[model samples]
Structure formats: C-alpha cells, structure tokens
Target: MGIIDAHHHVWDLSVRDQDWITGPQLAPLRRDFPLSDLEPQARAASVDRTILVQTITVPEETPELLALAAESDLVAGVVGWIDLTASDVAEKLGRLRALPGGEWLRGIRHQVQGEPDPWWLTRPEVLRGLRTVADAELVYEVVALPHQLPAAVSAARHLPELTFVLDHLGKPPIVSGQLKPWSAAVRELASQPNTVCKLSGMVTEADWHEWTVDALRPYADTVLDAFGPQRLMFGSDWPVCTLAAGYAEVVDATGVLLAGLSPDEQAAVWTDTAERVYGADRPNQCRIRRVSPRGDASLD
Candidate 1:
C-alpha cells in the first residue's frame, strides 16, 4: 500500500530569506531543507506521491515550487502561496497558473498565524483574493494557530464554494494534552462541508522531547469524528517535523492515530479525500509512482 503525503516543504538555503526559521523556538530548522534530503525519507515510508508546499509567502517561492514539481516526478501536486490581500489577486493567480508546471499548482496558502491581526481572514482584500481562488478552481490551505481558528472558520462560511484544507489540525493543544477550544472550533469548522482537515504538523505542537502517540490520539480522534474519513487526509510536515520526529515516525503516528477506523475509512483518510479535494484534474489512484500523461513537466 502507498501513502500520499499531502503536506510538506522544500526550500533552497541559497534562495531568498526565510526569517521565521531564525526565531529561538524554531532554531532547529535554520538550514535549507531541499528535496535532496526528502526523497529517501519519502521512499522509506512508501509515500509514492507528495504535494510540495511553499515555505514562504513571497511571490517568487510559488513559481520556484512549481518549477521543482515540473522537474521531480515524486511531486504530484503543489500548494503554493499567494498574498491574498493584494488588489490584483485574480491577475496574480492567473500568472501563477501560466507558469511552468502551473498545472502542478493546486492551492493557495497564507501565513495567517504570523499576522498581527487576529481577524486576518476578515480583511476585505483577502476575501477578494479568496473569491478569485474559487473562480480559478484552486483549493485553499488554511495555516493558523489555535487563536486563528475563528478566522479560518469565518472564511469557510463566507466562501462555501472554495475547497479549504485546514493545516496541522489548526495546531491544537496537543502539548498540554487538552482538547477543549480546539475540539470545539474544529467541530464547528468541519460542520461546513467545504472544509477538510489535514492530519499534519502534529510534532511541532507536541512535547518534541517527550511526545507519544497516546498524546496525539485525542486530537486525531476529534478530526476523524468531525470530518470523518471522507473529509480527512494525512500529512507529514516533513523537514519541519524533523525538528521533533523523523518522517517515518510522523507516518507511524498517523497509523497509530487511525488504528481503530474501519478499513474503508482508513483508505479514505489515507488516499481518497485528497483526490476529491485537490485532484479534480486527474484520476484518483492509490500507490501511483507519478501521475499519468507521464510528462516530466506538467503538460496541462
């Protein structure tokens, strides 16, 4: 059986600055983590296909990722960034779609958690960009901390047609082993059919030095309950997760988290949901080494 890692990042250290990794808590991730270091880990875990996500919101990074996806057979899709608040969002999105491996580009993401504005999603310009996203048939990757859950929830309700993927399960309170407000917001967010949850980035939220599957179960259980198997998909935050656990460990933790789900439910969470969300342009096949049409670059 194969797994599709729905979330991961690859960046060149020689490229533009990634200031976020310089912070004290994130010091472990200070170096460049390119695709070179990622291939072996993906192979070890049987992750035949992966979606290459952009690490920064800068305009150039999206095109760079698309270029990588163009060259790498393992990159089945890409969730690139776009400044959703820009006035010419539609034009910008159109340009991204016109780039090389543009077809590999599948979604939009913003660093909502980094924004000083707690109500960042409510910005008029941001909604304008989201409207453009729906028009372009792209998905939205929701990256937010626990405090930003309400903003994400609000965006989901306002743009019912847009496909929104909640990253890292909204970075729930796994470290403290509590699931109150996190569970509440997740349930509310999942109540909207257009929203889906990615079981990614759990390691960064847990006690990295002392994390365990038992500590992650409650959070995972809520996502499975709220989104169900049909709306859930697995993700390994990759190099970033490496700060706490290895790629195999992240994959195994997801396996442990979903042990009790039925076979069909397990299949859906592992493979089906991502196909339904980011895969309208292609067929859904589990264990595919690479998408068909078999081009080194996206011919779409």
Candidate 2:
C-alpha cells in the first residue's frame, strides 16, 4: 500500500518571513521551502500523499495552502489555520470551504504550544470555535506542549464530536529523557475516543546532534500503548525534522521503532491509519507507488 505522510509544512519566505525562524538554531529553515523542494524527497520516500499542515497562524496561509494542494500531486489534505476564537467562525469556515480548491481543507490547527496559558484550549471561546469546527466536519489539530495536554483532554472531553489530533505526541521531553508527567498526561488525552496522536517530530524533540532510536523508543512505546496503532498516524514534520534528521532517516528510525509490531500494525502506522484519519481516500493527484510488506525499507 502507498504510504501517507499525515503531517508536514511548507512556507515561502518571499511571501512573509516565518518570524519564528528568528533564532540562529532555526537558521537552516530561514530559506524558502516551497512545495517544489519537498516533492522530490516525498516521491523518493514512496509517499503518495501528504497532509500539509499550517505553519503560521495568519488567515491568508490556509487559502494559499489549499490552492497549493489543488496544484500539487503530493499533498492530499491540508490542516490549515483559522481564527478559532472568531465569533463568526462557522461562517468563516464556510467561506474558506467556498474558496478555490478548498475541498482539500481537511483540518485546522493553531500554535497552542506558544500560548502562555495552559488552559487556553479549554477556555470558553475556544470551545465554542471548536464546536463550529466539529459542525463543519473538520478535524482540529492540537499543537500543544506537554503541560497543555490536560486542557486538550478537557477540550476533547467537552466536544467529543470534534476529532483532535495531538501533534508531536504532545511533545514529550525526549532530550531530557523525562517521561512520567508527559506520559500520564498523554494517556489521559488518548483515553478520549475522539483523539489521535502523530508519531512525528520526535527526532527534533531529542538531542538534535545525538539522538538514537533507543533514546526515542520509550516515548514511542508510551503512545503505542496508550493510543494503539489505529489511533496513531505517521507524520514527517518535514523541514522541522530537518533540524535533526533527514526525511528518509526519520522514516527509517520509525521503521526500527515499530519493528516489533505485526505487519498489519506496521501498515497502520505507515499507511492505513493516516489514510483513515485524514480521509485520504479521495481521488489523489499524485502517482502512487505501492510497498509490499518486505519493501518497507524503501520508505526508510
């Protein structure tokens, strides 16, 4: 079956500075990373489809991403950004859906990790916005820190109709190797039937220069035990992961981490789960390359 990269990002520097790339450490991503730059790598990895996630919170970016999805062969779905707190959020979502190529708008995300308040997601207004998102049948991507996971769990509990995808496995503290609080909180969020977690961005969370598959295994296993393969999906996190490992290397490491699972479970992480979560069954624009059970290394 063809693999699906459930999450990744693209940004054009000329359009607007990704201001978050301010620090010297993020210098590698200062240059423009257009979809053209990612296509070859994605194709090389046998990734037939990808869900393009939002990078910045600006309103214009979503439409631009939707348009890009309409043009690109690789991107099958888009998790764009929206002002979730807006009073007319439902109407705004309708307007977005009416935009060119807007049908690919499968989900919405915000940079909740940067929010100073851990309870921001559980706030009254945000919950209202999430209700609108659910009514429109769009998923809400939870880009939150470990401390903010409780609010995510509460929000999910409040609005069970809205599917919540926890980005970066709630960003466990791999570099520090501390897992307890994060693991427990993550399990709480996973306990919600409407929630899912991405097995992405772990490499960057570990020591950028010196991370091993062994170093990430415990955190990965934590989520595997908590959410199971069906509720977990694969994501490359692409350019962000480039800060630590290359796309193929990330895929390879994931393969090693999941080697203990049966072929069917491995398939869920690599293909089936993403397809099911992101609704990627729509007619795809990209040329697909199938991978047999023995050919999994091609993704690595």
Candidate 3:
C-alpha cells in the first residue's frame, strides 16, 4: 500500500524570509527547502504522495503552492492559508479555486497557534469564513495550540458540515510529559464526528536530541484511542520535524507507534485516512512507486 504524508511544508528564503524561523533554535530551518529537497527523502521512505501545508499566513503563498503542486507528481494536495476574518472570505475562496492548478487546493489553514485570543476560532467572522469553506467542499485544518483547543472544539461543534482537522494532536505537551488538559481537550475535539487529528509534529515537541518512541507513545495513543485510525492520519511535518528528527526517522517512529494495530488499521493511518479527509483523488495513471530493498524504485 502507498503512504501519504498528510502534512509537510516548503519555502524559499530568496522569495520571502520565513519570519517565524528566528533565533538559534530555528537557525537550521532558515535556508530554503524546496520540493526538490523533499522528493528524494519522501521516495526513500516509500511515501507516494504528500500534502503540502502552509508555513506562514500570506495571501500569495497559497497560489505559489498550488502552482508547484500542478508541476509536481508527489504533491497530492495543499492546505493553504486564508484570512478567516476577511469580510470577502467566500469570494476569496472562489477566486482561489479559479486559479491555476486550483484542484490541488484541498483545504484551508490559519496560524491559529499564533493568535493571542484563545477564542479566535469562535469569532462570528471566522465561523462565517469556515462555513464558506465547507460550502466550497473544502476541509478546514486547525493549527492550534493546546490552550486554543476548546475554541477549535467549539468551531467543530458549530459547523458539523465542515471537517476540522486538528494538526499535531493540538501540539500536546510531550517534553513536559503532561497529558491531562491536552489529552482531555483532544478527546473532546475527537468527540465531534467531523473532527480528525494528524499524528505529526510530536518529535519537535519533545526533547529533540533525546526523544524516544516511548516518549511519544502517550500522545500518539491518546489520539488513537480518541479518533481511531480511520479518523487519524500520518504527517511527516517534514522540514519542521527535522528540528528533532529526520524524515525517515519520523516515518520509522510512527511505524513503531502503530505496531499494535492490524494491517487494515495501520493502512488507514498510512494512506486511506489522508486520501479520504483531503479528497485527494489519485488518477489511475499515477501509480505509487516503492523503493526496493536494493534501493531501486518499484511499482507498489
């Protein structure tokens, strides 16, 4: 079976500075990370397709990603940034779909993690924007911090028609080993039938240099129990995960975390869930290729 990385990102420093990539800790990510750098790594890991997600909230970035997706075979879908509070948000969505390679625009994402107000997702304008996204037959990805999960839950409950994808398990407190509030909030969000969670970004949340699969198990297990494999998908979180682990390491760790599941259940996390959630229709001609034990590409 083919695997789909549900979340990853790329950026060109020459085009625009990733303003968020500041300080000594994030220095490694300051350089450009184009799709060229990721394709090989993804192929090496047997990842047939990926969902390119937005790193920064810029209006122009979405179109650029769509164009890239149009040109690439690996990128199956894109979750882009859009100003949820914009008065003409619905019009914006329509215009975005009308752009070149717009069919790859599977979902919308905002940096809700950076918003100061914990209740930002509940704002009237934001809710209206989310409904517009739903009306457009798109999913809404929630990139929220743990404290903001209550609002995410509220938004999911309010818009049953919209599929709210919770990124990074709402970024649980892995380093601190705390689970209470984070786990509780995640369970609550998962209770909403429309809500789904990505098993990504945990490596960066832990002690980067010393993290082990056991350290990540709790957070992974929580979401698995809450959302089930059918509602949960795997994400590399790519260049960002490099802060703590390499792409292959992240993929291997996820496999270890999912070792207890049946093959069908594991298949859901590996590929099926992402395809279903993002509506990424794989064409008959676009067969997935797997790297052989001898390091040659072979049809899956």
Candidate 4:
C-alpha cells in the first residue's frame, strides 16, 4: 500500500570529489546528481520515504547530510560516513550524536569496498568502531564488494548485537553473468539473524546498455530467499541506477518481480519493514488530492 526507499543518495558537486567515479567501470556516472533529481520521479512512482545514504566516506559529509535531511521532508532518515579508523573513533561518534539534526542520522558507513585489504572489517580497530554503532543504537550500512563478504560476515558476527543493512545486494556480478561465489557468500551473511539486504543498485552492476529485469532476478531472488520478506527492503538506487535505467524503470521492474508474492509479503518488502527497522514514518502516507492542479490539497 505504501513504500519506503530504504537506500538512496544525494551529493552536491561543489564540494569534495568522489574519486571512485573516474574509473572506466563507472564512466557512465560522471554527472552531478542531487536530491532534486530524485524528488519528482519518486513522487510519481509513490515511493514516499527515503533514507539519504552518504556518497563519500569523509567525516564532514555526515553533518552536511544531516543538515540536508532537516530541510527535506522526502529525506526520512540518513546513513552517514564516519572514519572508523581514527584513534578516537568512539569519542567522535558520541560527539556527532549531539550535533544539530543528529536525530535524522540513523546509521553509519565507511567505503569498505575501497579498502586495500580484504580483511579490513576484521581489523581490531575497525571492529571496535563497529561495536560503537551498536552501542549507540544505530544501524551499520555494509557497502562491500563480493570478495569482501567474508570479512563482513566476521565483523557482523563479532558485533552480533549491531544490526547491518547490506548495500547493493553484495555488488553481484550481473554484467559477467556469474553468481557462484557471490551468491554463496551472500547466503552466509544473510543466515545471520542481525543482517538484512537492500534490493538496490543492480542496474549499475548489470549490462547497462541492454539489461532487463530478468538479468537481475537471480541475484535479487537469492537475497529474498536468504533474508525473507520481512528483512528485505526495496530501494531505487535512483540517479546512480541511471547508469542503466531510469527511476520509473527500476521501480516498475522490481514491481514485476514482486508480482507473484502475496499482498502481505509485498507490503513488508515495499514499506512496513523499513519503517520498523529504521523507525521512520512512511512518506506521503496520508494526503488528499483535489480535482484540479490549482485546487486545494489537504491531509486525508
């Protein structure tokens, strides 16, 4: 009946550089995409609430996003960046909690996918910082490449009390059409009671120019099977997914795959699950429309 896009992003071009976008693997994503670009499309598709995920791994980016959240009703929550490797990591997190708009900050993330070490998450310092996330009552957004899944699993196990949201469906290999290692690894992570995966970002991983929903189904199915309906959440990776398809296509294609599921199960994947996990209100949940564009609008 309603939907909460559990994962999405917003970035201002005038600020710091996103160095990851320069590579050939991501050549198609070389433009400035901000919250405005996503607002109109999300409204049309009825994706009411969104978690504004951070695009950069710098400390300053978190506060900037928290400020943005305060100004935008569309932004129901925020997953922000924190340098977990710093010596005083615990203190930093506590300090951030007292900042303005901090209530909108519901989670923390680091670009672990960019780490040189495959076992980065298992490192003592990083694991210590991850524990702080659980201690502070926030979710941890696990954004890792396929190879890094094992370390993610280890970290997740060490901090069993800390809840995790897997980003990009483990960055599956849709473009090459292989699923063995990735699928198996994802199953292991999802087997844990504390982990959940977002059904987002497949467009960028698949054959961008000539991909279809069928191409991404196997990966999405694996995650759905492993995590079940209540733990799974839908996300239109939006402007980022534009590298392959538009906002409407991403939403429509996901709807097609979900067609066979029961109304109750579909409700959780689309809306209820996110609200329960993130403590966020569904966007546009109760609004009334008038006969004309110029006519009155009010709460139903």
Tens-place lDDT digits, model 2, residues 1-300: 578999999998889779899888999989988888888888888888999999998999999999998898788899888898999998898888888768888888999999999999988999999988877777889999999999999998899777788999999999999998999999998887778789999999999999999999999999999888877789999999999999999988998999999999889888886776666767322111122222221110
How high is each candidate's TM-score? Answer: 0.91, 0.93, 0.93, 0.90
Model 4 per-residue lDDT tens digits across residues 1-300: 457898888766678777778878676677677888888889899987898888887788888888877788888888888888677767887777667767777888888898999999999988888877777767888999999999988887888777778998989999998999999999999877778778899988999899988998888888888887777889888778888889889999889878878898788789866776676763222111111111122222
Tell me how far candidate 4 lies from the true structure as C-alpha RMSD in angstroms.
Answer: 8.4
Count of clashes, each model: 0, 0, 0, 0
Ranking by lDDT: 3, 2, 1, 4
Would you give me the overall lDDT of model 4? 0.80
Regions of candidate 2 where Cα sits further than 4 Å from its true position: 283-300
**Winner by TM-score between candidate 4 and candidate 3:** 3
* TM value for model 2: 0.93
Which regions of candidate 3 are displaced past 4 Å? 282-300
How does model 4 score by TM-score?
A: 0.90
Residue pairs with colliding backbones in model 3 are: none
For candidate 3, write residues 88-133 as lDDT tens digits: 8888987887888687888899999989999999999999999888
- The ten-residue window of minimal lDDT in model 4 covers 286-295
